[model samples]
Target: MSVAAVLEKDYFTDYSILLDPYEYFDAMRAIGPVCEMPATGALLVTGFKEAVEVLRNNVDFSSINSTVGAGVPLPFEPNGSDISEQLEQHRDFYVGGDLVVTFDDGRHRALRSIANKLFTPSRLKQNQEYIHQLAKTMVQQAVMQGGCDLVNDIATPFVTLVIADLLGVPAEDREKFREVIDNAPPPGNLDQSDAPTENSPLVFMGTYFFQYLMDRKSSPKADVLTELAQATYPDGSEADLLDMVKLATFMFGAGQDTSAKLLSNAMKYIVDIPGLQAQLRADPKLIGNFLEEVLRLEGSTKATTRVARKDTQIGERKVSAGTRVLVALAAANRDPMRWPKPNTFILNRPKIAEHVAFGRGVHTCVGAPLARTEVRIILEHFLAATREIGLCESNHGSANARKFNYEASFIIRGLSELFITLAAN
Candidate 1:
């Protein structure tokens, strides 16, 4: 299809494109590395090089709109060649504008430093046993049931409790956290008309974390929460209570949601791809490479948004200041210029880490290491406990005409539910 034909459709809201965006991305890349979406006037970065350029250059591109994207209108009108002052003045108008993902430069650096405490090597090492035990128990239960809904039955609860333990959340509050997050719709859902302005699960999580941190500050305890509560900025000054709250809650919500979605995506590929499960089973080491391939092909985060802080160029395309830029991570990962036969999933693909599945530059997913460790451990347990794994024929139909449902969200790519039948080893 011609680029004009592709641009004719609003890739953000169009339901058909949301279901399977690969074809749409392919069409966009055919035009150029960066093409303007006439519908929203957002520049779509479909080429890997262009995506890297935008993601790495925080000087010219601001992440103020990272969470909301182009779907939401800027609070203030763009003036002259720079809207930096305007963005600051109206920052609160942007949805999730207070989030760490939306912060830039010094603010981002300071907040990220405090949040980094939760993912320290020693902290994750401490949580490793809990992750393994949970995965083993969950896999064993699925084996006994013969079939399971992978999203709810396994991934959601598993990742939630893991994060709870890592964050030092009280045992009594873990189940409530799980229930609130599980019931909340994933971000960027197309069906959510008020997505741009609506309060997310982060709001609720933030409330709890706010109270936890406040209490920790007043009554110090020997826990991660106390550490976070007292964490100082790089300047050795105390961080704001609200900023810490935002970082903590954002971590809890983003960490679990993205990780859970990733697990479901991995399982979908494992059962759908012929001989994949057996191959991973034979050589457990291959599971790491297999997971990378899955992430490259269908990572949980499909795309991320950035706004140009100043007039700039992404490849050959000129972007005006304040223009919204949609860095298509999924599309860029599959760019033929970077990956040979980008659409096909090749195990042990060379330089697999090069893919921007977890993003690039400073804003890379903070919980990435923990995510990789937990998902890999769970997959290992499931594969070890099961002799065979296949999709539920009744729910997904025959192999020839398989059917699956994906979350109706532009930003997130994940299965709403995955039904799988397993044979215990």
Candidate 2:
């Protein structure tokens, strides 16, 4: 067994070093830039240069046909085949938008044109007030309540509601929608026997949305769905409705959970680091630095997968066509070769943004700007409003056997719940 295989079957890697992940990554970096994980038959890239290579070299390794559950440790099943199919079904929907984060060539270019309008400098500036108001509401709701779980109470709603609003869902249905989606089973959980009819929230949502698209067809409002439904290709043809459902579910699923994890981790790290939090509370200017550093030190979503289009070299190992590469963003973010004094979190770390938390190249993360903005808005409100919040329970549900007791899951990396109590300034 290779070193990686041993590490996976047995968490021989000093994982406490991973409570601060940089250490583990640094060790991996020393073993050449990339190493193969025998356990999953996947290549693990830990160096900044090679990892970036995997992302930037689009022709050699394609992101479009990448499988989500290809190779990773997970507690639950991940239906790699079905999820991959659903993801690809929405390709034409982005015909007029810049789905820059996940597409290539013609599709990516089309999205770049259409999505540009939504993220224009003026649009972002205009939404500043709207963003602040939502952040204010989140803080206010938890204000007199004394202590609050940042993950469950504040972060989830603030970001989810904002994305929903941007997507054209009725604000009234936001809470109910968030509840349904947040707990939706992982794509792996889908079973052909079940047919999404368990009267579960996921079922309700799947049914409601398929029907919802039709209901919005007549005199459609100017929401994202309507725009998506109404959007035309270069040939002036309407996008298919099936594509719309795929995009809608992607918007909600990808937007809510990922952004919330970032917000939650960012806030928790800020509160946990007294000196840094105090600096932000006073200067406010440091918030940007704080954000970058958090992304660097504690990434939002941990890892993403890509498949090799053809034979290629990953670090010292030669990878053949169809090899699965697991880009450990969290580990790569802390790679020693990439950053100076890698493990420590200095709020003003000059090279902080190098972290691959948001990803890179064709499939980097479409929601990155929005995710950063949400974190910025919420943190700005919290820093200005509250003086202190602490983790009431540093609870660990399962003993982290791996280098970080990382959820034995393959795809998304996040807290099940980060329980905390907030005290007002």
Candidate 3:
């Protein structure tokens, strides 16, 4: 299909975008790294080098929600048929001056400080056993079925439960959270705002957890949930219930889906390439190397957007203070300049950690270490158990490289579903 044709269907809607990502992405990359979007009048930064440059330049660009307006464009289609109403509601967090993503300097540092307590090495260590168990147990469930869709069968359950546990979602609500992903109307035909806002089952989950947060303010529990409950404002004030709700929602919202797809995509390719799978199974030692390779090639969160803090040069283009720049992490991870034969997936790519799948700047993903650890462990146990994993005859095709479903949402990249039939030894 021609570029114009793909842009309308895939780029305009969430569901369609996931249907065949590589084709669309390759076409966009061919247009040059920093091309302007005809519809939104914002830069669609698609090349690997430009994306890294934009992300590394924290002084000139920022993640604050304030930048999300017309000045900064979302990666996918605009669904806010009623833009004014969307802005009004968005104003709540936007007015906070800066949240984790959109703020800069002192403000960004302050927000990150409150966020960091949860990520303390000790707190993370406390969760190691839980991560290991969750990975094994979830993997077993998929194995039980003989054949499985790794993304939905194993990945979603594992990541979603982990987030749910962290947020103190009652075990009862766990299924409900998964249901949102299972049933949320993907943005194909649905108008975007109509895309379920955070207020559905998620709203209740956030509110229920916020109360627990309030209860632990004075008497802090050792858990991260309690720490988040008590996270303070940039000033000396403590976070309120609404603040807790945002934090609560952002916890799962920021990651679960993408984490699921990261595993699925890696699993999909590794299993198909029996040689690579065999190599990993024999030397489980290379699980870290394999995960890094997967990350560089098939990143979870494809792109992140930031608005220019002031009229400035991003490599060359003069962006106005409010101009939004979309940094394509998926594209950058494969930039030929940064990696050898950028398009091919080499399991032993050197210094693989350099890939910015977790991003950079003050807003760099706080969950990077934990996420890496989880993906690593998941692959280790998985590769160790299986002899050779591959696509069932039914699922075989070159479709993966040419077409793949990533989360169509403007915010993240992940597969909607990954189907694979595994042969366990």
Candidate 4:
């Protein structure tokens, strides 16, 4: 009946919940589709239909509080049925408010246009060979060592370089970008404070991208950066230089982090499940559907935040102005109403693409296609090069008593380290 009785722990700050969230998601869903958390006054949308309703209705719900969720208090008190004006006035005060993810309406559309250029079908087609070659080379090196921490040795570097190449970041500077990102704390890492300090990677990345875009404007070049610098809004007007820089850096940071986590998450299943590796290896075509199932069961992002622009109803629950809504994508993906036996992983599940792993509506992830390509290519390579794939007993113990550490974050869900043994074919 009470939040404490159901959840038993703080969903945001508690470490145990971060390690295993599916049980808690079940608890939340048991209450109601759209249940309100009395502690934070944030409604948690755990049902599939309810989550989709909230995601699609951008008119009544603004993404201003997306990054912070209900973790922080609103700058001003809600007085009426619409706090849209207040959100705008104090927008700069919210975390990640200026980033493209939080932008709404026209501004969001215009900025997304410029970001989309880098991920065009033709652009990804051109990068396909590079992705495959890079995956092959990286997986080969890991196989040479017999075993490697898949998170760091393979997934992290593999996705990082893939994004670097796609974005036209210079080859000479790739390692520097990798080092800067690796050294920086993950967005919501719990051991360290989650708050962004002066040393945030965005500041560093923004500076580098700013200089690059500025140079491209002055001296045009045959690169994605040059095209992005010259790209205009839907109305054919030029975009702000600072906005462009923010978009580029955000893409760079988000692109690698989520995709790397996804790769590690998929590996956990590949090794844990009996004969799954051999099945995929023998029939490479099943790899795409297998990845879709992984996304459904263990998506990198657990939940995204939205704030009510005005009074609205999410399902039967009435959310007032300024109310914070936590759209639980991971929970929605497993909702029994949507997927029968949602907890069990079934290969080749019907309509697998309907999962909200990358989210939905106008605010759906712009990098979804790129993330899929990176993971699929690397997975194919790992299967091709190895006779057998398994977990390192030293790191994860044996199958019955397996112990693993997940990154401490309320937002991202991923293994901290996935050491795996590879038997080369």
Q: For residues 201-288, write the lDDT of model 4, one tens digit per residue.
A: 7878889999889999999877778887888998999988899888888888889988999999999999999999999999999999
Model 2 residue pairs with clashes: 74-408, 74-409, 78-188, 79-188, 97-111, 98-111, 98-112, 147-422, 400-405
**For model 2, how does the per-residue alpha-carbon lDDT over 1-425 read when each residue is reduced to its tens digit?**
23453454411122343244444455555656787665566677877778887877776664543323334232223343223333345434322122234465566555544444444455556667878898898887776687676767777777777887777676677788787766654331213112211224434554556766887787687566676666565556665566556556556656776788787778667656657678888888788778788887777655566666566776657776656676777777777778887778786787677778888875667677778787888888877777776665455232232112332233445555676566787
Q: Give the C-alpha miss distance for residue 341 in model 3, angstroms.
A: 0.8
TM-score of each: 0.97, 0.79, 0.82, 0.96
* Candidate 4 residue runs with Cα over 4 Å from true position: 1-4, 191-199
Model 3, residue pairs in steric clash: 18-405, 48-332, 63-101, 63-102, 64-102, 407-414
lDDT of 3: 0.64
Model 1 — which ten-residue stretch has the worst lDDT?
A: 192-201
CA lDDT of each prediction against the hidden true structure: 0.86, 0.62, 0.64, 0.86
lDDT of 1 at 89: 85
Model 1 segments more than 4 A misplaced: 1-4, 218-222
What residue pairs clash in candidate 4, if any at all?
none
Model 1, 1-425: lDDT tens per residue?
Answer: 56677778987788888878988999988878888788887888999998998889988888998777766667778987887878878888888889999999899999888777778788788888999999999999999999799998999999998888878788899898888877876677677634633446778878899999999999988677888899899999998888888888888888897889889999988988899899999999998888888899999899999988788889977888888889999999999999998999899999998999999988989898888889999999999999899999899899899888988788889888899998998
